[model samples]
Target: MKKLLVITVFLVAASAFLFGATYRIGLSLSTLNNPFFVTLRDGALQAAAGLGVEVIVADGRDNPAKQLGDIEDFVQQKLDLIVINPTDSDAIVTAVEEANKAGIPVITVDRGASGGMVIAHIASDNVAGGMMAGEYVAMLLGGKGNVVELEGIVGTSAARDRGEGFGAAISKYPDIKIVAKQVANFNRAEGLVVMENILQANPNIDAVFAHNDEMALGAIEAIKAAGLLDKIKVVGFDAIDDAVAAVNAGEMAATVAQQPFLMGQLAVVKAFEYLTIGTIYIPVDLQLVTSK
Candidate 1:
C-alpha cells in the first residue's frame, strides 16, 4: 500500500510539471491610492484570469525606492514577466536594468522607463492629450487668459511631455499667459493646497490646467473655497469618472481621457505574447472628453 501511494504521488507531480500549471507574472504599480490605478489593476487581474496565469501585484506607493525594491523582489522570485507602472521615469531605469540582467522580460504600463531595455511600453500619447487640453482652453478663453498649471510628479515622462505639449499649443496665442505653474505631485490633497496658495498669489487667474483629474478636482475645491469657481475654467487629464461628472455639471471645462484599463489589459496581453513569441510595443489612443 505504501509503494502504491508513492507511485500515485510521483505521477501527480510529474503531470503538474508537464502541463505547466501556471505562469507567474509580477505587476509593480506606481500607486494604488487612486481610482484610475485601481481600475488598471482590476483590468490586469481580469486578463490574467482569462489567460490562465497568476499575477502577483506590488504597489510602489509613489516612492522610487519602494518601486525599485519591488522590482528586485520580482527578479529574485524569477517571475516569468514583470510589468511596471513607474513612479519616476528616470528613477526606474536601474530597476529595469536589474530585471533585464535577470533575463526576465519587462513591460511598462501607463509610464515608461527613461533607460534600460523595456520589452514593451503601453501608454497613451500624453503629449497629444495635453495639446488637446491646451487647445480646448485656448478656445474657451478666446485665445487670451492668464492660466495656472498644476503639474504632476517631477521626473516623470508623463509630466514632462504633457507640459511640453501644453506649452507648444499655447505658444501660438501670445495673449494666453501662464501666470504660475506648480507641482502638486498628482495628489488631490496636494493639488488643493498648492492651488490654494496659487490662488492667493495670482488672484485674477482665468484658467487652470492640471496634469491629472485628481489634481484638477483638488483645484476645483480650492476655487470653490475662494469663490472663484465662476471666474476660473479648469481643464484636466485622465477623464476619471468624477472628472467626467464634473464636466457634465459644468464645473470643469474639459479633459483628455487616457484609458488606464485598456493600458493594463494590453500590458498583460503583450507580456503573455513575449513569453510565448517575442517582444512587441503597443501605443494606445487618448480621447478628449468635454461637457457638450
Candidate 2:
C-alpha cells in the first residue's frame, strides 16, 4: 500500500510540473481616460493572453488615494506580482512599501515611486524628450520670442522631469522669455481653460510648449480662438495619434514620441521573467515627430 501511494504522489507532482504554473499579475494604471494609457493597457492585456497568465487591471482614475486602495486590494488577493503606473510619485511610495512588506514583488511602469523596493522600471527618457521639444520651440521662434509653458500633473515624475529638461534647454536662450507658466493637470479641458487665461495675460506669445499632447492640443484651440494660430508655434510631447494628426494638419509644430504600447508589453514580459529567472530593467527610446 505504501509503494502505491508514493507512486501516485510522484505522478501528481510530475503532472503539475509538465503543465506550467499560471502566474497572477496585478496591473494598476493611473488612469484609462487618456488614450495613451488605454493603449498601454491593451498592450499589456495582449501580452498576458499570449503567455496564458492572468492579469487583473485596476484603474485609479487619476486619483492617488484610489490608486493606493487598488494596490492594497491587489495585496489582499495574494497576487504573484504587482505593476504600477503611479499618478503621483510621492503618494505611491507608501503603497509600494506595503506591497514590499507583503513579500510581493513590485515593478513600476512610466512614473516611478519616490520610495520603495521596485524590481524594475520601464519608461522613456522624459527629460531628453522635453529638451527636444524646447529646442524645437526655440528654433521655430529664432531663439527670441515670448513663450508660454503648460505643465502636467503636479508631483508626478513625468511632469517634474519633463519640466526640468525643458527649463534647462530654454535657459540657454536668454531672449526666449517664458511669459506664463501654469499647470493644466494633463487634462484637455483644463488645458483649454488655463491656456485661454494665459493668452489674455500674454498677448505677444510667439510659441507654446506643453508637457503633453493633450495640453498642446488645448493650447492650440485657445490660440485659434484668439486668431493667433498663424503667428504662434506649438510644440508638445507624447506623440499620441491625435497629436500626430494635429502636426500633419499644420496646427502643431512638433511632438516628442514615446512608445507607450511597447512599454506596456515589456512590463508584462519582464514581470514574467522576474518571477521565473531574474530581474531586468528597460529604458525605451524617444524621438521627435513633426509634420511631413
Candidate 3:
C-alpha cells in the first residue's frame, strides 16, 4: 500500500511538472511614441491576458540596434516566443536568426523583416494602403497638382512598399508632378522641419501625402503657419486619433486606416497558435478612412 501511494504521488507530480508551466511571450514594438504603435501594444496586451500568457514588451524607440538588442535579450531569456515590430526590416535579420538558433519561434508584426525565419507574420497590406492614399490625393487635385511626399524611415519594408504603391498610382497622372520628396523619418518634429524646408523650395505646392499621420500633422502645422491650409490639401496614412480629429475639423483631407488593434490581437493569437499546432502566417486587413 505504501509503494502504491508513492507511485501515485510521483505520477501526479510528473503530470503537474509537464503541464503547469505558463507560456511567456516577448513583444518588441518599433516605437511607443507613435500613437498607432501604442494602440497596437494595448491590443496585444488584451489578447495576452485572454490567453493566460505572460508578455514582456520592449520598445525599440525607432532604433534598429536597440531593437536587435531587445530580440537578443529575449533569446537569452529563453522566452517561449518572440514577437517583433522591426524598426528597420533589413537590420533585424541577424537578431531574428539568433532567436532561430536558440530554437525559439519568432513572429513579426506591423513591419516585416527582409530576411530570417519567422513562424508567422501578421500585418496589414501596406502597399494597398499606400495606393489608396495616392488615388485619393490625385482625385483631390483633379489629377493635376504639384505634390510633396513626406516619406517614412529609410530601408524599412513599410516605407519601401508604401512608396512603391503610391508612386504606382500617381504615375497614372503625368500632370501630377511630385515636386519634392523628402524622408521625414516618420517623426512629427522632423516632418514639420522637412515640410517647412520643402515649402521654401516649392511655394505653390497643391497637396501633400505623408507616409504616416505624425508627418501629416506636422505638415498641417507648417501649412497653418504659412497660411496655406486653404490652398494645399494633406492626406496621411494611419488613422490615429489626432489625425481622425483633424480630418473632422477640416484640417486634413483623408487618411488610410490600418487596423492596428486587430493586427496586434491577431499577432498574439498566431503566436499562441504556432505554439500549439505549428501554424504560421496570419494576414490582417486595412481600410481607407475619410472625414465623416
TM-score of each: 0.89, 0.89, 0.89
Clashes counted in candidate 1 amount to 0
Per-model lDDT: 0.87, 0.87, 0.87
- Model 2 lDDT tens row, 123-153: 9999998899889888998899999899999
lDDT against true structure, model 3: 0.87
Model 2: pairs clashing at backbone N, Cα or C within 3 Å: none
* Number of clashing pairs per prediction, in order: 0, 0, 0
In candidate 3, clashing pairs total: 0
Model 3 misplacement above 4 A: 1-21, 280-292
